[model samples]
Target: MMTFAVYLIVFSSVGFGSMNINSHYFNKHMEKLLVSRTFGLAGIRNIEDFWIFAEGPMLDSLFPEPGEMDGNIIVGGPRLRQAKVQNNSCEVHSHLKYLQDSCYGHYTISTEDREAFGPGTTSPWVFSHTGSDYYRGLVATYGGGGYHLELPSNKIDALQAIQALRQNNWLTRGTRAVFVDVVVYSVNVDQLLIAKLLVEFPPTGDALPSWFFEVSRTSLFSKSKDYYIFVCAMISMTFNVYFLLLEACRLVYLKLTYFSRFWNYFDLSVSIGSIISLRFGIKNYLFIASTLDKLPDGVDIPSFEILARNGFNVKVTTSIALSLCWLKIFYFLRVGSSTLAKIRVSVWSCVLNSLGFFMVFVLLVFAFTHLAHHVLGPHLHEYSTLGATTTSLLRALLWDFDLEELQRSRPVFGPMILLVYLSLVLTVLWSIPLAIFARSHTDVMSEISRRCNLWDQWKEMVWGQYSYRQGKVTSEEELRLLLEQEGLTDEDMAAVLSRMGVRRGQHVDSHHLRNALGCLQDAEMLPEVAVRWLTDLKQRVDAAGQKMVALTDKVHMTLEVASGDGS
Candidate 1:
């Protein structure tokens, strides 16, 4: 049950389900924000012109049933509530007021929308300065005829013109003043709704702001609901604390020798990593939150924002520690079942004992991989680099088996060469390691069986010595002799006696036998083997005791018969 609980904790620590929930919640609104920000048709001097430029043929696809252009903005909101628009001849002033009153319709401009006249150009005969010949022709034609017109071109050319107009700020006053409105949004349904302070750019210019941009709520520390994040942090800290306490108790009571194990040091390191990760995470979050509170509109805080979004140093360290923690679950297999224990022991023994075979396998792979690269490098791009060649060969060995690529690269000899390479890899690299593992498995199993059998025999010897001693003390020599008589040789009896710390010629009693059994049981010796061996040993001891008793009785009866004859 304790092992099961540990497994459950390890699985739960991944927290992938919660992460998925967070992603789904944010993705819905993020898509809307991306659409509104990237393709939002606001602040364009000519909606039709910008649409033609941005979307090309896709313009019709976007607005199939064109009723009116989308200009979703409110002028007299929080930021513009205190501003007054100065009189200006620019058509944009009229457009702003039009939006405030009607709040609908597309924006358009007349042909005489010139900011300056060339020195040589006549009145109503506008001259082009920093514009294309196309623009100059349009200006001359419009100035001569006094007719309002929109440019006609394909999507590609129109988009280029629109880009030029935006860079020049053709719609603003004098192209000198800039205005911006920053709206902080919290997600509502599938769209962003304004939740906090509205900030306008050019704090000293005309109190009216030009356009707006949306930012996520997490940018503002006060608005971000990071309570769930904090809760997760607390859970991680609690888990680490539990780990430290357990490790400390083991070190204190299970002997200081417990700390010598690699796993104990590993657990300590992960616990330390968890603590440091949480510490830095909280510190960085609070720092970002404070920075967000001080940020002004139209100002960027890229570093802090990215840190909050992706968790900076905290994510790396926490992930490292968490991955290590999950791997620790395999340690429990050492105690779970006999098969599990055998598997763990077998794998380690196989890998360590077969290092020479593994080295040879690597040598073969490297050698043939370079040979293939030399032959196929010019034809096959995957063989262009040594790393790429190694990867391709390794993949083929694993049965990814894309020999067709080689055939395509080299039409005549590729198939034959590939067959030879595959044979070498299959026979030398794959078969050799597999055979080593199989042999090592048999050897390890035999060793485990031999150890268990010795444990059973040792327990039987201890029981036999205690019974034959007849509740009195007996030397180790007597016990060794008795066990030797029972088929255990001097060497075998000495090995068992040494394990039990029974010095030669040292006295042993029943108490010693009971203590030896306790130790063997604690060491996880097979219980059924010990029980069966002890049952048979007790029967043998009884038979020996009865024979001794019968011999003594016969000697007494003979003495009595001799005394009666003398009388």
Candidate 2:
């Protein structure tokens, strides 16, 4: 029974571990997808120019504009609107070849522009007016020249312009920043074509801050393995619930009997906690995925990243819960056959014996902790506090001492103190306690073995083919064959039969077997022990039977005399 339970727990843990690995990879894939959508679209394209233009009011429309920032502004582009045509604006291209040549090696915002704009000037054409450092920095770096400076008619035109830039190598997939300059006219706003020009540049090794707004792709769910995650979570939770039910049934049936064991509570706690943790973990991921599904592309949902991070945390918790659930495998080794039972007993005996050693070791550790804190605290940083001293000593106990720290302390004195400490801790205290525990473990096992031998002998006699008026009768040839199979010689069989006093062709019963076993236990020193015991048992039985017959006769005579007197 115990073996079966152990196999079940092991199989469940393996399944859970596989699911955890899959979920981890799934999270990584999702993160990569997010990064591709957010950063890949605006990467630097042209090596020489290091500038890519973004057309129209791209991501600005996804968020509500700040009231303090001007509504219509072009941050880093030409101020004229198609040379101000009479009825409609005509496309006019401006040449900045002279300016580009001068700023080839020194691509920077014009000093006059910087002074006039003053970091973040609120104008219809100012990029920093929106108060976004990402766009503002891009405008300051690459918005000087080699820009399209066009107004897009719609969002599609804006997407096409970005895609064309990427294809033309003017906008690489690795660019980190995109600058947009929008010019909104209060009058003739519809004819103005609410559009902005974006300039992208390569990142300077510094990663974008977390608060930076990011664009998301439309097919968020398609890139993730949420289906597999959900399935695994469901399967794992179902198994945990099954275990919970089993524990409940055991509690109901065994009542106090089940509660008496410590492992029962451990299993119950793991089962309940795993169920709860897995449920909440699944809920968190699903909620985040659903929320992301409802959001439009290029929309900056601030909570999306936060929710993703929270989901990852829950995933870690679920993994930990799975790990804790594996502790139940130990509970299954306590029952079943005598061999397993003996193992359980011996292991528990070792644990109980080790407690004494642990108690003594803890006291010694505290003493050393105080000594280290006082003596070595001034010289070594590790020993500066009582907690630190205790921690250092604990690590030292495991042979993980920091040699550098010891060497850095008062050179000779530190080595001498450490040597003495190691001598007391490793050589004497550690070895002695472990040795004591080992001795106790051996002694307990030896005693258990001795008792188990007697148990085996009794069981063989009472249950095997040797009991009197019970169990199967074995012929002499059959018995000889069995002994031969056990590696016993013919002489050994003959001696055993002689000790039991069983003649040729006579059936041997439980009495003969019991006597033979008793003689064996005493090294064949008292072969007649079982004979004497059987004779005594027979005499007692015969006496009791005679007493019973007499009692019956007396009862009948009393009844007949009473009837005659009545007549």
Misplaced by over 4 Å in model 2 are 1-226, 290-316, 333-340, 350-352, 378-381, 428-430, 452-567
What number of clashing residue pairs does each candidate have, in the order they appear?
0, 19
Candidate 1's C-alpha runs over 4 A off are: 1-14, 21-229, 238-260, 276-296, 299-305, 308-319, 372-381, 412-418, 466-567
lDDT score at residue 430, model 2, on the 0-100 scale: 59
Q: What tens digits encode model 2's per-residue C-alpha lDDT throughout 40-93?
A: 323324333222212322333322245633333322222211000011112223
Count residue pairs with overlapping backbones in model 2.
Answer: 19
User: TM-scores across all candidates?
Assistant: 0.47, 0.44
